[model samples]
Target: MTTSRGGDGQSSVEVGTFIKTPSAHIVEILAVAGLDFAVLDAEHAPFDFGTLDAMLIAGKAAGLPLFVRVPDFQPSTLLRSLDLGAAGVLVPHVDTPEDARNVVARCRYKAGVRGYSGGSRSSGYGEKGMLAAVADAESVQIMCQIESIEAVDNTRAIAATQGVDGIFVGRADLALSMGLADSQHPDVLKATERAIAAGVSQGKRIGVVASSLEERKRYSDLGATWFLHGSDQSLLKQAARALVRA
Candidate 1:
């Protein structure tokens, strides 16, 4: 298979369904369970910098690339996640070109103007040159969430942004964007399928946030190569209902 390098031109690795959760130990456990990458949910989950750092350390120790899903579009949040040693940062609700551009900036050092600290998991905790490590890792993976009509309309431009390595689609918010309280119509699936088509055509890795594995497969045929498999907090509940139902 051909290796697809990120903006940094480093090893282009394939990641499986990365579930969100607050525990670093669980992150490590999942890595051992055979996941290429794992993301710490800093966006929707209750977690602090200290906890995030520990997760990063655990993920790295387990030889898994760690990503952070930040809560918002704040550049500071994006930079902090990278500086703390996250392999990439996922920003949610990216609707405009400016939003895409600004989020991408957080992946750089000098030009990115990120606040740098060498003694972090990214630099091996002071064992490496902090600035260089960050610059390299900054370009690792910048996943921008596209979950609205606004984002869907600007989908092409967002994927074409300089620092973006992949596109993540949040269907629930997207459904709302289309003026539906929740998507039960084929129209939502059509919109998502279109987004995936755009992503594949642009050579960008397309990802989806599925409520379940079966739901994700619906889009897998549409060229979705990545998935957010399960969340740490909800995996059992999901499995119980989906796989172990009575």
Candidate 2:
């Protein structure tokens, strides 16, 4: 139900791209280009803790919100990302309400078991004081990814879970899990719609990775507010290909 607003104070579709290059300069460039956000693809990319630490710092310096897509549902991974000052986390393969609940439990403090460290960057290195720090940390966005058929069926419940800030539909994995080769296959589209609709019904923000402007519009029409258009690698490859053609 929450929307990202532009400088003009108008609600606009949130646009971002996947950060797979593992470069702090790339993160700065994306922010300078005016992207609404960026997700460091730690799940698929070779980003170690030190690398992530530098990139997160770059994102902060560039005035960009950087969310990390963690490799798994490990509490340690989530804890580390948050500790390093990631804006939020995109937890993948959250197939059930229990999984969603577990994510919330791991990321929160008062209501869950997130380890506390006043010296961490997230707490402003003990400058913000414990109460203010806990408040800010708990405010970090927590999005659950719906990637499989089972996840689609439970999308509503997952969105309905408290502390779940949004639902991100992972169509690529959904297609593969459904035995399809195309992410845009009709069945995949249908499942995407179903998941989005379920999240909307629960009054949750919806997000998706759209390969093209048309694809982004299609999902936008289906109630997806946040869109990740492509990855740094894909965009670079495209620019290089276009340059060679030119």
Candidate 3:
């Protein structure tokens, strides 16, 4: 994870970017651009195991903590992502404390029903041994996305859910659920604030996707400790547009 510096020379928040292209080259570019970490947007992008493996290998070589945002809260997907050596996993549409709990359970062997196997790549393919592998797997971060009004109302309970490391606000979906097209609407902001406060009160780190550096700072000020900005596809479009104008 990478922390951004404020005027005071201290970084209160960590920042990264989202990857949607499923390319190892894109992941390498993120590393060279000095990003601290990255999340493969598997929820929207199609990535087979070979592709994920390639990106994960690239991320490792670049010394970046690569994570995967699974399409759902399925235990098999979570387990497979971890087995692919993701630093963590982000599960989407977590609407209740129970959902959050289940996500965490899938990430850990002792607490939940994650099928254990030390022969996976995450365990050094048996090099690290089974006992040590279990411990390492347990340390992987689990981030639950709170994307609905129901989740916002149950924010405190979700944050307090054991083994949950953080809560990521999916503003776009939250906005859609509120019958709005703008995520910056007053109601959406209010719900975001409430979720942030609940996470802070429970001593859990809060996360959000920032469209710009300014927005990132704004969310940081609002107690969002983790921020993801931009994406491979968006960056490509912006660059291509600039080139056309040039």
Candidate 4:
């Protein structure tokens, strides 16, 4: 796990939070809520790289692991995200060996030539311990999204790609790719399970975004150690309901 800036920068285990939708205050909210890590969703959400940096700053202020889920398999985007100081990066649609390598390289520094700016949130905004920070960026957390049949089929090879830290199953998108309207179908469940199992055997941490605590438990039982429990919108709806009940 990457050590955050402050606020009990003292924890050991890694807890990752996903930010799929947008809100300027999301980073501050989740950070104060005690999340070990938080991700900005650039894939499906409307967040630009600049906004991502801002969110990272907010999360870091609270000592939360700051990460960004880049839009696609583009190395430039991934490189930009890493340079901005994402504690880690979640690359979506990792369906091939090349895609996996692309992301892995983005995390790398000198050996890979990712552009650098010393004074940024990523390198403690200065030269202080920048080399160590670069090393951490290379080996830190790299989560690949399993969201299609291609990824499901290429699971073993994808995991074998050196430097990948974990897997996050995108059930909804995978279902859509498989021509299913939703993730409730048994077929999608089987595919998701297969991916999770493959990840476990390969010694990679497995994860998914569960819609509820029950769903979280179910996936946890299936050996997913990393869980991005739900979306910003879902949390809001649940909180609103609770407030109404209260």
Query: lDDT winner among the candidates?
Result: 2
Q: Candidate 3, residues 116-233: lDDT per residue as tens digits?
A: 7777889998899878988887779888899999999989999999888889999999999899999999999999999889988887778999988898888888778788987888
lDDT of 2 by residue, 156-246 (tens): 9999999999999999999999999899899999999999999989878899998889988888777788999889999999999999999
Alpha-carbon TM-score of each model against the true structure: 0.85, 0.96, 0.93, 0.87
Alpha-carbon deviation at 56 in model 2, angstroms: 0.2
After superposition, candidate 1 runs with Cα above 4 Å error: 1-21, 211-215, 239-246
- Top-down lDDT ranking: 2, 3, 4, 1
Worst 10 residues of 4 by lDDT: 3-12
In model 3, which runs have C-alpha deviations exceeding 4 angstroms?
Answer: 1-11
lDDT of 4 by residue, 97-183 (tens): 778877787677756656666776667667657777676566657889999999998887788788888888999999999999889
List residue ranges in candidate 4 displaced over 4 A.
Answer: 2-16, 20-24, 244-246
Candidate No. with top TM-score: 2
Clashes of each: 1, 0, 0, 0
TM-score of predicted structure 4: 0.87
lDDT of 1 by residue, 1-246 (tens): 123556965434445555456676787678887876767887777788888878887877888777788888676787678777777777899998889888877667756756667776566667778656755665568888889888888888889888788788888889988987766568887888777787777778788866666776676667676777657657757767887565
After superposition on all C-alphas, the RMSD of every candidate to the true structure, in Å, is: 4.1, 2.0, 2.3, 4.3
State in Å the error of residue 150, model 4.
Answer: 1.0
